[model samples]
Target: MTFKLDPKMTLGYVQLRVQSLENQKAFYKLLGFTIIQESATEIIFGSGSTTPVLILTAEEDVVPRPSRTTGLFHFAILVPSREDLAHVIGNLLEIGAPISGAGDHLYSEAFYLSDSEGNGIEIYRDLPRNEWQVELDGQVNTATEPIDFQGIMALYNPERAWIGFPTGTILGHIHLNVTNLDDAISHFYLEAVGLDLMTNFMDSAFFMSAGGYHHHIAANIWQGVGAPLPPKIATGLMSFSLILSSTDELNKLKQNLLAQNVSFSEVEGDLFVKDLNNNDMIFYTQA
Candidate 1:
């Protein structure tokens, strides 16, 4: 934990493999994302920029992820305001999307859903930083209480048309299903990646982040206990990016990774490595 992560760094994008391309594309369209790039095998979507927030690649007849697999649990997309979150809910209601759960963490309000491939997705809005709760140790505390549905609905402006994610919409955070929380914490995240610990949930889940703005990454063994990595063609998470703020930070991480002899690949000048479960994580700095 000696390497101080740059608080400004955030998740870049998430890549998922799907069984059906058109079906997943249709689902994302309903959630208000525009296609930025498309091909026969893959499609990339984003709110406004050429930089994609979500990437879906078609993998036909691949083995579906098992219930207790160690892979993606969910990836969250953070909107700018509560009203934006309301807009997302309103749209989901119109499409009859199956909402899994809704929670008001002390720091944010989030609604969850599952895609056709059973990949979890969360759309949420963060409360202002000034409103967040900080513990005595400079870490944050979060509670999974029920959201105020009435108040959230009140913020929805039926007068305004719901556009795709606003210009500021971002790929916020990612939660993963791992086999061992201790290994993830000691071997990967805290010791090598150098993230700040935020909170621990029942000794089953650990939330960590670069800044104190809540969790940028979380790992849990809720379903996948002592599981192994999914097959290469598994229909779930393909890869994700852990972006760095500067080349110096990226180089420091590279050095740490080398010290541990973690095998990583350099793709187009960016570094990519795999976690213990073999999930690919690319590291790079934004221009």
Candidate 2:
């Protein structure tokens, strides 16, 4: 029951069912996500690399999901440096992008915003590992202090004028709204999915990660326990992916899920399952 995943385990692209592809595209484009691919109903966004990070799919009849439902809370994007992260803040300011909030969470400084479809987004830069505050249990201690905006802006260089997300930008972490905190923490992410419980808030939320790097995924009961799933055809997170390092690591996860009696299906060598929060998890091997 104490299964551990490969340390290199990382998240992949997040797919959201949006209502207005045009509006969402325009918004993410301003944030420096490049359009990697496009079709009649979907537009994919990526950073400097060919790897896609976000997929926006919209149908004519798609509607916004209600706020008090179980779905994505936000998807956090990790950039490589303070300068790049500051550049993003400047870009949003220059374009008049509305910011929901910003935070300096000890280990990282982040800015929060929502997409055109109301899907939450976080753009952040991590302080170096040596700079993080660690607890006696080897867990990282994080807090929400006010970010040093003036200092962050001081790192900004207008001459660099970076056009898109820097090469090292990646899908860092994802937070979700779940119906039950206990089920999500005990039965789903920790035991079955092989993530380690990194740390937790005052019982309303918990952060989980693989290989102990702050939090890779988190869930909260802020909407109240027993929250209902978002309506189908609702515009929000439909699914997201986590890529493992190898087939062996994938097998370990499969065994962990089996041991926990969690149902999963294999399709074309990829594993598919739904979490306790009704969030779709697609696990696949990248190396």
| Top candidate by TM-score | 2
- Candidate 2 deviant stretches above 4 angstroms: none
Q: What is the TM-score of each predicted model, taking all chains together?
A: 0.95, 0.96
Count of steric clashes across candidates, in order = 0, 0
Model 2 residue 264 CA deviation (Å) reads 1.1
- Candidate 1 residues 81-137, lDDT tens each? 998888778777877888989999999999999998899999999999989888888
Residue 176, model 2: Cα distance from true site in angstroms: 0.5
Taking all chains together, the TM-score of candidate 2 against the true structure is 0.96
Candidate 1 Cα outliers beyond 4 Å, as residue runs:
none
Cα lDDT, model 2, residue 259: 84
Which 10 residues in a row give candidate 1 its minimum summed lDDT? Answer: 182-191
Error of 2 at 64 (Å): 1.0
